[model samples]
Structure formats: C-alpha cells, structure tokens
Target: MWTEVNNSLHRKFEFKDFSEAFAFMTRVAMIAEKMDHHPRWTNVSNGHQMFLQTVACKNSIQFINRVFAHSNQ
Candidate 1:
C-alpha cells in the first residue's frame, strides 16, 4: 500500500532483482504516460521507491489509489 506524506503519495517496492525492478518501472511508465501523470521515483539496489503527486490537483490521493490498484494487479 501507499502512504501520503507532504502532499505526496509514496510507495516502496522490493523486487527479486534489478531486472525485475526495471521491468516494473517500465510497466508503470507506460500507464503513467497514458494517464498523463508522472511520478517522482528512484531505484536503489533491488528496491524502487515512488512518490506521486498531481500538479493540477496539488496532491495524488485519488490518482495514487487508481494507479496503485492497477499496479497491484
């Protein structure tokens, strides 16, 4: 699940390896681009951390819920 802090929706995910992490990023990037919403993210070792907030809405509470639901599947 993701948490909200400082007006941002944040999530941290651990993968099996670097390859899996990058793959997950690729998948997320595609969906994000289609939604016209982008997230702040980082990859370190086998973990990926993401922070999502909408410039238009000033927060990502709604968008994050939708995105997280899709990503979980």
Candidate 2:
C-alpha cells in the first residue's frame, strides 16, 4: 500500500532477494517509460522503495494513478 507523505506517494516492497528486488525495479522502469514519467526510488538489501510527487500544472489524478499502479505492481 502507498500513503501520501511530504507531497509524494510512497511505497515499499520486499522481495526474496536482491535479484528479485532488482527485477521489480526493472519492471517499474519499463512501465514508467511507457507512461513517460518516472519516480524516485531506492534499493536496500531485499527491499525497494519508491516515491512519486505531484507535478505542477499536471493532472494529479493521473499522476497518482500511474504512481500507485506501478508502485503496487
């Protein structure tokens, strides 16, 4: 699940290993490319964290949907 924090949607995922975590991140990158948007992310051990902030002059609902959709996947 994701929550609003500091103006960004934040989520964390845990995987079986570093490779699994990396694979998830890769999927996220591909999705983000397709959406023409990107999120801020980090990897630590077998965990991955991501955040996407609402941009000025953009559709916040769309951004939120994209962020959470990909973040959950």
Candidate 3:
C-alpha cells in the first residue's frame, strides 16, 4: 500500500533479483519520458533483493501496475 508523508507518496517495493529491479527502473524511465512526468526515486539493493522508493501518485500507480505484471518471471 502507498502512504502519504509530508505531501509525498511513499511505498516499499520488493524484487526477487537485481535484474528485475534494473528492468523495472528502466521501464520507469521510459514511462516517465512518455508521460512527461517523473517521480523522485531512490533504489537500494542487497545481493539479489531490491527496494525502491518513489513519489508522484499517477506515475507511481502506473509503474506499480506495469512492473508487478512483469516481475518475478
């Protein structure tokens, strides 16, 4: 679930591996370019796991849906 903090949206996303994380980030860049809107983001990884931080309601929602569809496979 996404939460609001200090006027910014926040969420915790988990990925199975580094490749999945990188792929999602790449897709986000593409989406942001096409939409002409970008979110502030942060990415952290530990070995094969990934955690992402993003804010921008519309962009975040769209990204989550698209990435969830393609992740872990």
Candidate 4:
C-alpha cells in the first residue's frame, strides 16, 4: 500500500541496477502521461522513490488515492 507522506502518496522500489530503475521510470512515465498526472520522484543507483500529487486538483487526498491505485498495479 502507498503511504501518505509529504502531502503525497509515497512509495519506494528497489531495482537491480540503474538501467532497470530507469526502465521502470519510463514505464511509469508512459502511464502518468496517459493519465495527465505526473509524479515527483527521485532515483539513486538502484533505489527509487516516488511521490504523487495531482496539481490540477485541490483535494490532494483523493488525487493521491487514485494515483496510488494506478501505481500499485
């Protein structure tokens, strides 16, 4: 499950390498673009962390929940 932190839904994922981590980000980018919802994220070596909040919506809680559901899949 995604956790609420820093006014967003936060998740951390570990990858085998930078290549794999970037690949995962690319995949997620496509999905995010399709949804018109972008995420704030950081990558370091094989570790990745993401925070999702909808800029278009005033209700961040609901937007975060929707983003969490989509990302968890």
Candidate 5:
C-alpha cells in the first residue's frame, strides 16, 4: 500500500532480485512518461522505494497502484 508523507505518496517494493526490481522501475517509467508524471525513487538490491508528489495529479496514485500490483508478475 502507498503511504502519504510530506505531501507525497510513498511506497517501498521488494522484488526477487536486482534485475526484477530494475525491470519494474523501467516499466513504471514508461507509464509515467506517458502521463508526464515521474517518480523519485531509490533502488538497492531487490528493494525499490518510490515517492510521487500529490501535486502531480490524482491519477498518479491510481496509476502507481496498477503498476505495483502487476509488478510481481
């Protein structure tokens, strides 16, 4: 789930490996680019931590969830 903090949405995701985590971030970037909304994040090993400013747009949160939900697949 996404946590709201500092007027932004924050979430940390873990993947099977670094490659998996990197792939997920790549996918998110493509989607975000289409909407002109980008996320700020950190990646370390299998962990991916991301934050999206609420000011971006309401759909950002929804879009993030959709991507996150399917990331495991």
Candidate 6:
C-alpha cells in the first residue's frame, strides 16, 4: 500500500524476481513518459520503491503512489 510521507507518496512493491520487477518498471516508464510526469524510484532484487508528487493546480499538490502487481510477461 501507498503511504504519504514528507509530502511524497511512497510505496514498496515486491515481485517474484528481478525480471518481473524490471518489467513493472518498464510499464511505469511508459505511463510517466505519456503524462510527462516522472517519479523517483529504486529497485533492488525483487523489490521496488516509488515516490511521487502530483501537481493538481497552481496551489494544490497531491502525492500519489501506484503499485503494479506483476504477471506473466
């Protein structure tokens, strides 16, 4: 699950293996590129940590975290 911490949305996800984790990151990259909004993330072995902050308007900001469940790829 995602948690809001220090004005950032933070989440940790676990995958079956490094391959699955990498595939998940790749998908996220596509979405980020399309939205023109990138996030800070870290991957190690079978785990991934993501941190994001979303700008809603000129004065409003929301932090959000999306966890991707890995499947056969």
Clashes of each: 0, 0, 0, 0, 0, 0
Candidate 4 segments whose C-alpha is farther than 4 A from its true place: 63-68
Summarize candidate 6's per-residue lDDT along 2-45 as a digit string, tens digits.
67666666689899999999998998888777666677799999
User: Would you list the C-alpha lDDT of every candidate in the order shown?
Assistant: 0.77, 0.75, 0.53, 0.78, 0.72, 0.68
Predicted structure with the largest TM-score when compared to the true one: 4
What 10-residue stretch in candidate 6 is worst by lDDT?
A: 64-73
Measured against the true structure, the TM-scores of the candidates, in listed sequence, are 0.79, 0.78, 0.58, 0.81, 0.73, 0.74
Model 6 misplacement above 4 A? 54-60, 63-73
The lDDT, on a scale of 0 to 1, for candidate 6 is 0.68
lDDT tens string, model 3, 1-73? 5555444445556778778777777886776566565556667771222232344453334555435323423
> What TM-score does model 3 achieve against the real structure?
0.58
lDDT of 2 at 53: 68
- The CA-based lDDT of model 5 is what? 0.72
The 10-residue segment of model 1 with minimum total lDDT is 64-73
Model 2: per-residue Cα lDDT over 1-73, one tens digit each: 7777676777888999999999988888888788767778999989988877656535243455554565566
- lDDT string for model 4 (1-68, tens) is 57888667888999999999999999988887777777889999999998777666663756545655
Evaluated at residue 66, the lDDT of candidate 1 is 60
Cα deviation at 13, candidate 2, in Å, is 0.6
lDDT of 6 at 41: 90
**Descending-TM-score candidate ranking:** 4, 1, 2, 6, 5, 3
